[model samples]
Target chain A: MRLSVFHPVSSLIYFAAVLIATMFCFSPAIQICSVVGALLELFMLESKREFFRNLRFTVVVWLAVAVTNPLFSHKGVTPLFFINGRAFTLEALLYGVMLGGSLSAVIMWFKVFSKVFDRERLLYIFGRKTPKLALIITMTRGFVPKLKAQYRRICDGRKCSGTYMSESRIERLKASCGIFTALCSSTLESAVQTGMSMKARGFGTGKRSFAHSFKFRFGDGVFLFVCILLFSAAMIYSGTGKLRADFYPRIAVSSEPLPMLCFAVLCAIPFILEVKESLKWKFCLAKI
Target chain B: MSKKTFSNLIFLLLIPLLCVAGLLFFRDKLYAWLSVGITVLCCAGYFLHFEGKEIKSAQLAIISAMTALSVFGRMCFAFLPGFKPCTALVIITGMYFGRESGFMTGAMTALISNFYFGQGAWTPFQMLVWGLTGYAAGMLAERLKKSRPTLLIFGAVSGPAFSLIMDLWSCIWADNGFVPPRCRKFFVRLYRNDAGILVSFKEFLCKITENWQVRRAQSR
Candidate 1:
């Protein structure tokens, strides 16, 4: 009873399909999907410890967005009321929570998507003619790691110098200036070095071939087909002119039932699959 | 890039960004003292970095005085209700320094200060706008430093002019937050508010603008 999940690409296709569907539904369904998606991703950490290593930053970002958004927006009718002169409206807080959660979820999902359709895989799929696209993929994939590593090294260097005084404002600013100078210089150098490395490897050469790790099995075909169906249905719903933006002082209600149901079905697919896989894993582990 | 350098930059950027977010969120309670404290801290930070050199002392004293003037102007602006003269602090610093230094100062100041107001997503844009204003002021300062009267004029005009520039940036970011769909009226009202302050300080604006225009026109 070991749980089996779709390949990353297939998983991504399904997620994208669901997202597009939810967007077309033009109601509160998008918020639900986003929150559910974010929670499911978060739960991945709780249930499977290994996933946390990859998702910790993402989760923090999501939480930050969720927490801070409500604090600032201060909109809506439901009176949570009274922080100083400002009346923190229940509606604004809730909306901000939804908006922030959804925004973070979408951003994290895209991050996951990039991880799934990794630079090498995408490059292999797209081939050498598209250098700009390849460069973008490489940078996007590498960005977080680069920033994280850089942040750590600078802190370490400061610590080693015994100049790392977190308590003093002036000391921190000097350290920051030193760090900024160092960062700008190194980044420029790295850009040049990376360019040279690419050239040395004959990046522009037409002789390169890529063999992707993901093979399109029968299951993959089913996943892709289902995604296509979902995406097409979503697009059709949008074409009928029912999709609308409800963001402002108030959230809008959707008129069409067909769009809503179809949207719900699409958005709920990933959650269903994830739950199925998790439960299956649990049952199998119990037997052991 | 070396791992060490990259991490350092992120850490530096993050501190100010988070601080600003905090500032923005809590600005109502903290605005009066927080702004003054940050302005002092920035100048103090500069002084501490250079230690006890004679030139450093003079520069530090000047910045300290500037910080005091900025706070005073800001407080006076509050009383005047719509006079936003303190936006010149970053611009003046930038003008005196070069563009790069001005940019760094402006960005860092805005980011750090915004923390007291309460940090949100808008912090980055404010940093960028303020940084750009500083950079522009620095570039302009270099071109006008030749004559005493022109320098004085530039100094006088920079305060209110920068408020206009910063407002334009804020308008772009906060349009969704407060502005209605038909925002032409809003822009007009904003322009009127800004222009009204300049009109009240007519002598100051006139002196600065006259000198600025004469120099600018001469250069052309």
Candidate 2:
């Protein structure tokens, strides 16, 4: 049960929970939960540095979006001023930033989830009857690695062929295009062969059996119960419109920060205990 | 650093000035292409010139100024609205500098400014539009600064025009349902009310004064 925390099911459940909570709750609920989900994914996913780096990138991108958005959107109750014959309102810009931050957070969360749920595991979970779709998802999962490998190959080739480091952006873009074309051609060929192999084995037609390693355990049940409680509380606050989120001409109070912080802490309890256990073991070993 | 470098900088400035003037004069395909082409060219030149070079303190300061201005502008628009862009500060700053400054300003403004505004749906296009605007401005500035008059004229014309550009960009996003169609439609509907129209007209008058103030501030 402790080991399964490192598995894909956790991420799946996390993703599903985020999606459901975001869909059902108010906008603030979506924002807060999504942020909490991203934070958890960042801290507990083992790839903490990568997650933090991506979070920083998301912040940078979110700022860019916030600046450009307000000029066009002059909506909402409070009017700040007017620019160039337009009534520029704080509401518009606030909404833009809120929307942008939520989006970036969601994207960051998904990326963290993907890191935990690699293609092999995704296929393992859904492979028996829907082999074709499973294979596609698995292949899609490797797209970034394949693309990077091909890009490196093209770069090496270009350097070997006397392409200087001082090439223009356009030239670099063109070089990448060449690499992409090569990769696409090869990937298509491989896909065809894979399709043929799958057809031969009757991959799509079968009574599906679950060979995946997600066992229903006591800890998982306990974790899920706590998750449900937290989510239900979030949903209650959100659905009642009691979870306020305002920022424009003043500030919007979304969920109470303390409660959200407490929820975040509760979610981390398992990982915290795991670390404490490990540290205890190490201390015992040193004593011996 | 040298007389030749100074002269080269002046020469580079002319190209963008011409592009901006051409865009204003032509108001069609050539105008759009002119700014875009000159910007791309200047960005290429900047890359070539500054390749592998560490940024000087002054350059870093300028970059920070640009980033701060962008963030300030975004926050103002989001929370205060009073300090919103009467002039396209991002565009002007970018044009005066280079692509690196422009891109950073554009990108950072969107992200940091959202601190006051919760994350919403319309962020991606906002990032792209501002980014392109800064990138274009920098390129134009690099290409057109041969004469002071041209620079001033381009600055004046672009300041007001940028507001229009943003409005149009919003229209594209709104009509296409890219994000916030409901919010947009609701606002427009509200504006269609008689009181809203009067308020909008009053806002228009206020905007002109705000624009002038921004211009004066920029000159300093």
DockQ of 2: 0.01
Against the native complex, each candidate's DockQ, computed on alpha carbons, is 0.03, 0.01
Q: Residue by residue across B178-198, what tens digits does model 1's lDDT show?
A: 333224444565566765455
User: lDDT of model 1 at residue A269?
Assistant: 58
Candidate 2, residues B1-220, lDDT tens digits: the string is 5445744764678676766644443222233334334544444344334333444333434444444433433432333222234124555456555765565456445533443343333343344455666677677775544454454454445443444444544443322233464446444644344242233223322333244345558879
lDDT for each residue of candidate 2 in A107-127, tens digit (9 for 90 to 100): 665555455555566776546
Query: What is the lDDT, from 0 to 100, of the residue A32 in candidate 2?
Result: 57
Q: Would candidate 2 be rated incorrect, acceptable, medium or high by CAPRI criteria?
A: incorrect
Report residue B196 deviation for candidate 2 (angstroms).
40
lDDT minimum window of 10 residues, candidate 1 chain A: A18-27
**C-alpha lDDT of residue A224 in model 1:** 73
Candidate 2 — which residues are off by over 4 angstroms? A1-11, A22-24, A27-37, A44-52, A76-82, A85-97, A142-166, A169-179, A193-212, A246-288, B1-220
